[model samples]
Target: MFLISDMLVRIVPLCLYSHTGYYARFFTYNVIGGIAWVAVCVFGGFWFGNIPIVKNNFELVILIIIFVSVLPVVFHLFKRRSENKIITKPLAEVVEERAN
Candidate 1:
């Protein structure tokens, strides 16, 4: 289940991007959601270990958590920073052009 969710989380973004150019929010949402997922996974693992059923799935759960959480946040942050940097220089140029 966790693996499936991770795959879906990844594929959905690609699918959205292919279908639409304006799905940038997915990046932001993915970052935020991924953080939340990691928090839950780390803490939940600790808590769930107290329960037998949850403990049995610990490895799978951790793998999914890392995949779903770490990947999206890291990818999105890099993408956002790179894009913003590209725009900043152009934006300054436009401002200078307008001022003159």
Candidate 2:
């Protein structure tokens, strides 16, 4: 909670400060990350409590939190990449047409 919350506090406002609609984007993304963190923590705690390898409870919790934080960021990046691909395809085709 603390790590995510700290990131939210820093990122959300910074994004907002840059432009108008950034506040909305910031809130929406932070909420999504928050929800994912909650879900992962709940499931990990209940399912893996007795795993001997992750014996220390705190370490297990931190690992779960980091995973939650990272996974969503990766997903977001992948989505951005796909969106960029969609945008660039038409522009590339136009440039090719001009070249021809």
Candidate 3:
């Protein structure tokens, strides 16, 4: 989940030039990936939500959601800071710079 968007932002353009009809390939995998995540979140929640420990802790579930969602942004910021890169730089600019 964290990697997908990051990957698309950074890697998809390279794939575009290197592969024939790369977007089609991405779409295929993207659908499968989406379905897999949905299944896990829904059925896994249903499967595990019945557990006494998990079911009793609504706060834990909220925390898990916040952690999963926010950690990626924090990691991205940290990576940019470490590399002395600007987080707000346009993706196209980064792609073009790397290409040269």
Highest TM-score: give the candidate number: 3
Weakest lDDT window of 10 consecutive positions for candidate 1: 83-92
| lDDT for predicted candidate 2 compared with the true structure | 0.80
Q: What is the lDDT of residue 22 in candidate 3?
A: 72
Sorting all predicted structures by TM-score, with the top scorer first, yields 3, 2, 1
Cα RMSD to native, each candidate?
16.2, 12.0, 13.0
Best by lDDT: 3
Over 1-100, each residue of candidate 3 has an lDDT whose tens digit, in order, gives 8699999976876577458757777778778988999999999889888888888997898899899999989998998889995468889998999999
Which sections of candidate 3 miss by over 4 Å?
A: 1-40, 85-100
lDDT of 3: 0.84
> Which residue pairs show backbone clashes in model 1?
none
Q: Per-residue lDDT for 12 in model 1?
A: 82
Model 3: weakest 10-residue lDDT segment is 12-21
Clashing pairs in 2: none
Return the TM-score for candidate 2, rounded to 2 decimals: 0.35
Q: What is the C-alpha lDDT of each candidate?
A: 0.82, 0.80, 0.84
TM per candidate comes to 0.35, 0.35, 0.43
